[model samples]
Target chain A: MLKIDCKDKHFSEIGKTIRESKDKEIVIDNCLGHRYIASGVGGKDIVINGTPGNALGSYLDGCKIVVNGSAQDAVGDTMNDGIIIIHGNSGDATGYAMRGGKIFIKGDAGYRAGIHMKAYKDKFPVLVIGGKAGSFLGEYQAGGIILVLGVNTDSKTNVGYFTGNGMHGGKIILRSDELPDLPPQIISRKANAEDLQEIEKYVQEYCSYFGGEPKDIMEKSFYVLTADSANPYKQLYTSL
Target chain B: MAINYIYPVYEVVRNASRCVNCKICEKQCANGVHKFDAKNGIMIADESKCVNCHRCVATCPTRALKIVKSDNTYRENANWSAESMKEIYKQAESGGVLLSSMGNPQPLPVYWDKIVINAAQVTNPSVDPLREPMETTVFLGSKPDEIVRDKDGKIVDNMTSQLKLSTPIMFSAMSYGSISYNAHASLAKAAEKLGIFYNTGEGGLHEDFYRYGKNTIVQVASGRFGVYKDYLEAGACIEIKVGQGAKPGIGGHLPGTKIVGDISKTRMIPVGSDAISPAPHHDIYSIEDLRQLVYSLKEATGYKKPIAVKVGAVHNVSAVASGIARSGADIIVIDGFRGGTGATPTRIRDNVGIPIELALASVDKRLRDEGIRGNVSLVVGGSIRNSADVIKAIALGADACYIATAALMAMGCHLCRSCHLGKCNWGIATQVPELVQRLDPEEGCDRLVNLVNAWTHEIKEMMGGMGINSIEALKGNRLMLRGVGLNEKELEILGIKHAGE
Candidate 1:
């Protein structure tokens, strides 16, 4: 793999170097606060060692990104197709507007994860967060699948407040009791046998990436949140 | 229904002698304004459904059809006009905020008409553009605040990236979802042919138009729809849409009805889903935050494409512009209230932002005062009407101008102002397969090219009349402009003298 030390380089310079490289697989080391790494880049397997900044793997198309450490906000934003494996926690708006991708985060995530995730044609994005998730999870999501495992959290709640607010499509699988006091527009349900089957492949992939027993994880009570189609936010616009 | 409360605003008059019994008008109207009367063996009209798009009038074979605004009148109460009463009645009928397409039509002072162009006299001989070379070419992007040189004492060309336009006018951002694929294709093809650029609004670039990358400016808005790495790299320049002029603070809303087929793929959203963009980029809470997003785009594009920060002409727009100038934006596009849109709430569209003339003047002056004018090129647009308006805008310190409604008109739009209904009989805005097919991209492109080509030549003529062959000399040449029917306050804001002075 072609390796580069992005310790003190500006993000643009580093990005330029990465784009100019003909190597199919690349490794970036010592990534600090430099943001927008691998933005709109595709067709490569990028491995990052240190903590990458915000918008990591943003707009990443048809690539594989392996982040060894925690990442900041907007990971895999509007990503079309890719596999981003993050071993550590992530910041807010993770997987924002993601359309097609598999974002496997081992640790907890900040607010607004999978916000506006959608799918069209054969493209469906699947985001799996290992630990607990913050509030407004999957807000305004139109399609795709989001799974928050809530693995090893000391907190009482698995997912935070206002989860699935303005959510129109897609399914959010939370590994806990159904969230309470959400917008009346959401339809949260206990994942039954058929529901588990629907998410079986995604669960298998997440378990493989983050080291978990599939049966043990699936055994836990899971809840799915989908927007109520009958009330598709007519109030969003002013009435008269 | 109870009182025949509303009357049709327009009436179609057809002459029997000149009119052939052809069903072309019935076939052309998407609004169902014309129908063939089977028993009578003649064409009948449903004037209430007519939007006055003139499609039927234009399609009449023998020039037999004509449309006129009906003398439809309410009681002569200046306070409650006909349109206002109709609007209230419509709202009462259907409890929905009235949505309008195109620019504000509230008789808000059109500064373009108020401003007058100055011509050269005996002292400065005017050149004939027909025979003489009048340079209309311009480059829109950040220039170095100060040129730096090495010990060799040679000046360095360290300017940021710039978009070189053969003409100073470019087709503004009109997304794929808002306009038809044919409209976008026409614009792209025309931009390519004209050596200018067309914007792929907030809607993502259609995959077919990727070949026009050299002439496309892809836009990233709060929704971040269709923004991918490839999209970021697809355009010659990237525009970050902070605010749109038509709905200043509000975000774009493409009703789910219009989101179908390739539009779904282009925008990466589901079919028949409302694509509502947030008003603000959640990541950018401040100018410092704006800087991060700006630099992020630059990084994503390898600092190759110029980054433009587009904002509406709000009260403190110039202040915001100064912040954008410092935020590493290569270009700042200030859109005034009169800017067009696919759909916007009528209230907001009519009354929200400042005029383009004042905003452009203020931004230009502010940038020049801060000595950061060279740091970003200023492109102003909102109802840029003709060559005179363009010349006026350039004199007020705009590097270039953007025109949308004019381009739409050239593409067979009749400005029926009912684009929100998506039944564009002229086939400019609607997405219905039949209506879309009506606008053949090949024909549309030629018309657009002809329009811009005509405008470019006219701009040259105006520049020649001013005894200024090069557009660069006319940059911020406010002395070449004079106000006619404007107040002192307007004159001060425009930074120009009275017509006689």
Candidate 2:
């Protein structure tokens, strides 16, 4: 394991050091506001301390990024394959357009979490927010699994307003009985045994990283939000 | 019968004298407009189904068919024209947004027509392009503001990654879902042969065209479709599509129906999922945000390829372009309102953005004033009609001009404006296997090569007439341009004098 101090280092310098280093397991300390950390990088275990900036692990391909502190906007953006575990809260667009990856957040996430997240073939992205998610959560989500546990929230609804607007695919499972005001296209129902079974591994994985019992978290009634058809806006156009 | 039946816009004219009853027109039309009446021993026409793509006219062995605008009347009113009435009827019946293909069809002012090029007369003799060597090759990327020297005082290579084009022309972005596979193949082959680039748009690169990576500009839009490390590394340059001119400030939704097989595979989506490229990149909101994306892409690609930011020529396009120039982008592509699209809302397409001509001139002047012009190369597109337009664009401060509509025309598109329906008989914009096979890639490539070569020759001729030997010398040389029928404000904005000034 290589321990690197990023006290006065630029983002590029830190990135260059990581790319050039032969060490498989590396740790970055004082990683404040350094964007694009481990972007498109693979085959490494990167652990960052301090508040990392936006786009952490963007286009991350087959790497594991563990952020000890909070992560800013656009965490795991367009990430093809990887695992990004954030111990603290996350900013906006936690998993923007990510095709394949697993992003587990211990605390709440900001707006547009898991927006436009898609799935292809065997690759499916899973974003689990232990705490509540901000407004416009899972907007335009094509495919993938987004689970908002609302770990410490007092309110019944974990997600904010306009949830699943323009969503065409995927499932948004919230551990709450009362549902948020979802968009017209989205259909909401209680998570069946099969649905819960499918996300059991992810829930267990999230609990492993964030420190919680999967059974305790799964005790509540989870509401699943999904769109029926893949093409929600199919009838919105008239050929001129 | 429905009371809101609008008359067909075009009428099929089949010449009885020239008719050979070959049934080629019926076989050629994908819209099913023509049919053979075996009992009548003749061909029947469905004018209502006609898009006037002229595919049948071109395919007819004996030149027996033609399409003409209908002479049908609905009382002449300039305010509420026949087109307006038909559009009203369409919306009233469907209760959906009227979607159209291709560019804006409105008879708005085309600045290129008003701008005229200058030529050397008595004072300076013009160089004959045939006798003298003329340079049309252009390199697009950021240039170092000043020369850097090593410790030994040796001049170091300060140049960034640059795309070398044999001519100042490139095939603009047109995705696989929007166009046909054969059309993409043709563009890729032609771009390879021409030493230019053809953009993959936002559909992502098809696996088959990976070999043409050197001549391709892979795009990343709001949706970030098909964008992985390999896709980014496959292209010569990566273009970030901020906005499109056809429907400025709006997102692109390649309908679920068009998402089939390869298109779905290329986009990395399901077989029938709507590929929604939202209006704004959810991650990008400000110039600072854009810089993050640019740097993120750079990091992903290891800073090897040049990154381009493309935006529609909206009212504040110059300001937007200036921001892009400072956003670590190596190239700024300004697409005008006349840019083509597979589908867009009719109202937004016609009424949203500004012209490329004015936008380019203003952006060039602004960047130069800020002394950051060398930070990024300017590539303008929207309606570069011919070689003349290309030359005019270079003189008006463009490193290169992107051509899509013209390239589509070279690939046999008749401008039928029915691409949204996916029934393009010319095979340029359809996905149906049979319809797509109509456009032979070899033939299409040959035609595109011929068109580009012809345009390059014309550009050289114009450059020779102007006593300019190299394309780089004409970059931002607005003194070589003069506005003929433009107002004072227009001339001022274009940074060109009126004719005979």
Candidate 3:
């Protein structure tokens, strides 16, 4: 494993140093507020000691990244085919426009997490927020799975307002007794046995990343929010 | 539902002597404008269904067809026009926002027509492009501030990202889903033949066109559709579509009907689902955020490709261009208000954004003043009609010109402004199997190549006439240009002297 101390290093330098590494497994120390460190990087294992900046694993493909501390906004942005596990909480847009891959945040997430995330064929991105999430969660989500655990939060609400706004496809699993005031475009339901079984792999994997009992976490009734895909398209111009 | 609506603006007039009952117009009209009335035993024209696309006229074997403006008129008032009244009627009936296709049809100021070029007089002699070498080749990207010489006296070049073009023109972005697959084929083939690039627009690049990767510039928009590792790697350059001039500050919505089959697969969205590109990239709320995305694309491609940020030419266009220049982008494309779109709100298309001519001049001046002109290349796109428009754009401080409407016209688009309907009979902007197949790629490519070839030749001749030898010499050389029928303010904005000065 190639280890480098990224103290006082610019985002570009960190990116370059990480890029120059020949080792498949690399460790970054003192990774304070450095943005776009492993952006579009894949085929390697990256372990971050401290907070990495926004857009940390943007466009990431087929790699595994572990963050010892919290991460900034836009973590795992538009990332595809990768695994990013953040031990601490994440900021806004945790999985912004992510098409594929799985991002496991150990704690609460800020606003707009999992916004515009999509899935195609076998590439279904899974973003599991361990704690309560902020407003506009899963907004305009075309596809993919976003699961918010609400693990340990004092807030009465599991998630914030405008959840799943303008969402067209995919499934959002929220582990909460009741959902917040939702938009007209979205529908929420209690997770059935089939739904629980469907998210079993992700729950198990998320638990592996940040220790938790799968049975206890999975026991609670999960709220599944989805876009009303039944909304038919109307021509704004002329009908004929 | 209220049923009474205004008749179409035009009437399809058929010459009886030339009408052979071929029924080609009846068969060819995608809008169902013409149909053989079996009960009447005659082909009847439905004016309301006609978009005035001229598909019938063009395809008429004996030149039997002509579309004339209907002699229908309400109480004519300049303030409330017939179209406005019709629009009100439309809204009252459907309660739907008025959506339009292509550029603004309103009588807005077209700065291109008001600008003119100066010819070589007594002091300077015009060179013959045929006899002498008049270079039209342009290299788009960052240029070195100053040349460095090595100990051996060889000039060391620092220019890393550059798109070498035989002409100062390129086909602007028109996505596969927005246009037909055959239309894309024509553009790719033409770009390859012309040694210029064609943009993939916000639409994802089709799989078959991956072979034309060398001539393609893949686009990443807010929707992030079909943007993957292979797609990013396929393009010679990548463009982040921040905004389009036609619909400024608003996202794009490709209706579900257009997303069929391969288009659905190419865009990576579900078949027949609306492909909505949000107004803002949720992550990018600032210039710094744009820089991050730019760097991400660069890192993805190992920094081998240049990143271009395409933004609408808004009121703060110069400042926006400056920000993009500082945003780690190698190229900046400012699409002016006259630029075409697959679909945009009619109000937004007509009212929003400034003209390209004004935006280009302002951006060039601002960049030059900021001493960052060499940091990024400027590409101007918005109704670049002919060689003169391209030359004028170059003089106004553009490295290259991107032509979408002009290119489409060359590929047999009559500009009916009905692209939103997705029933293009010319096979240019539809996804239906029959319509998409109507545009033969070979013929499309030939026409496109022919158009650009003529434009380049004209550019060379015009450059020669100005006593200019190279595109590099002519670019941002405002002295060679002048404004005609323009006020002092217009002249000042255009950075040119009046004609006969």
Top model number, DockQ: 2
Q: By DockQ thresholds, what CAPRI class is model 3?
A: medium
Pairs that collide in candidate 2 are none
lDDT (Cα, tens digit) per residue for candidate 1, span B1-501:
865367888898878788677989999888888888889877888898888999988888889899999996889587898888778877877777777888988888888888888899999999899998888899988887687998899988787889999999999999998899999999999999999999999899899999999999999998888887788888999999998789899876677867889998899887888786867776677998788778778877777889999999999999999999999999999999999998888899999999999999999999889989989999988889788889999999999999999999999998888887788887778789899899989999999999999988888888899898999999999999999988999999899999999
Give stretches of model 3 more than 4 Å off.
A230-240, B1-3, B146-157
Model 1 Cα shift for residue A87 (angstroms): 2.7
Q: Report the C-alpha displacement of residue B488, candidate 1, in angstroms.
A: 3.1
Provide the overall lDDT of each model, using Cα atoms, as 2-decimal numbers: 0.87, 0.92, 0.88
Local lDDT at A67 for model 3: 97
Interface RMS for model 1: 3.3
- Residue-level lDDT of model 3, residues A1-240, one tens digit each, is 999899777777778877777899999999888888788887999999999988888888888999999999988888888999999999999898898999999998999999999887788889998898999999888889999888877665578988888888888998877778888878888988899898777788888888888888887778898888723335445432
Q: What is the TM-score of chain B alone in each candidate?
A: 0.98, 0.99, 0.97
C-alpha RMSD by candidate, in order: 2.4, 1.1, 1.9
Error of 2 at B324 (Å): 0.7
> Comparing candidate 1 with candidate 2, which one achieves the higher TM-score?
2
**TM-score ranking of the models:** 2, 3, 1
lDDT of candidate 1 at residue A200, scale 0 to 100:
75
